[model samples]
Target: MNIKLIAIGKTDNKDLENLTNIYQSRLGFYINFSIEIIPDIKNVKKLSEEQQKQKEGLLILSKLSATDAVILLDENGKQFDSVGFSSYLQKYMNSGIKQLVFVIGGPYGFSPEMYTKANGKLSLSKMTFSHQMIRLFFIEQLYRGFTILRNEPYHHR
Candidate 1:
């Protein structure tokens, strides 16, 4: 199955961007992987939190196709260990999904409409992380999960 990560805004830190690129490149060996960045909403200071989420949600939804199985990276969602996450990826592949999309929403989080459209929600951790940092973390985990699935030494038990 093809996997994609959709996130809001750009990563301003060069180091983080480089690391993210490294993992993203590694993922290409195992699956059709790509990252799509939805530009940050304009004039956010004047918009209410709900308004900002609503606007960002629209952009997120626009990136999706009707057949995409969307998963939101939400704090309150289910958390899994490295091996478990590999199995989760296998399950989706076994199910024959064409595209599996995971989204990292804007600061205020996903709008209600976005939640309604999601097939599942996944949490990287209980602790909060900056959106920019989360991009690196999530992509690395995706690489790790693929390695684990291949029984590679990249992930040590």
Candidate 2:
């Protein structure tokens, strides 16, 4: 199965983008992987929190294909260890899924419509993180998860 990460806005920090690129390249060796960036909304200062989320949610939903399985990176979502995450990925591959889409929402988080559309939700940590930082963290963990699955030396218990 292919994996796709969809996140709101671009990472402005050069260091973070570079590090994320490294993991993205490493991931390509194991499977089909891609990151799609949804442009940040314009005139954000004019919109209410709910309006912003609603707008972002519409954009997020538009990127999804009918067959894609979406998993939101939500603060309240399920948390799993590295090995368990690998197993989770394995299950999807075994099931013959076409694409697994994981989304990192905007500043105020996802709207109700987004929550309803998601197949499941995953939490990287109980603590909050910047949306841009989460991209790097998630990609690295994904790389680590694949390494664990393949018995590579990159990951250890």
Query: CA lDDT, every prediction?
Result: 0.95, 0.95
Q: In terms of TM-score, how similar is model 2 to the real structure?
A: 0.97
The sequence of per-residue lDDT tens digits that candidate 1 reaches over residues 133-154 is 9999999999999999999999
Task: Give the lDDT of residue 101 in candidate 1.
Answer: 99
lDDT score, candidate 1: 0.95
Alpha-carbon RMSD to native, per candidate:
0.9, 1.0
Candidate 2: segments with Cα more than 4 A from true spot = none
TM-score of each: 0.98, 0.97
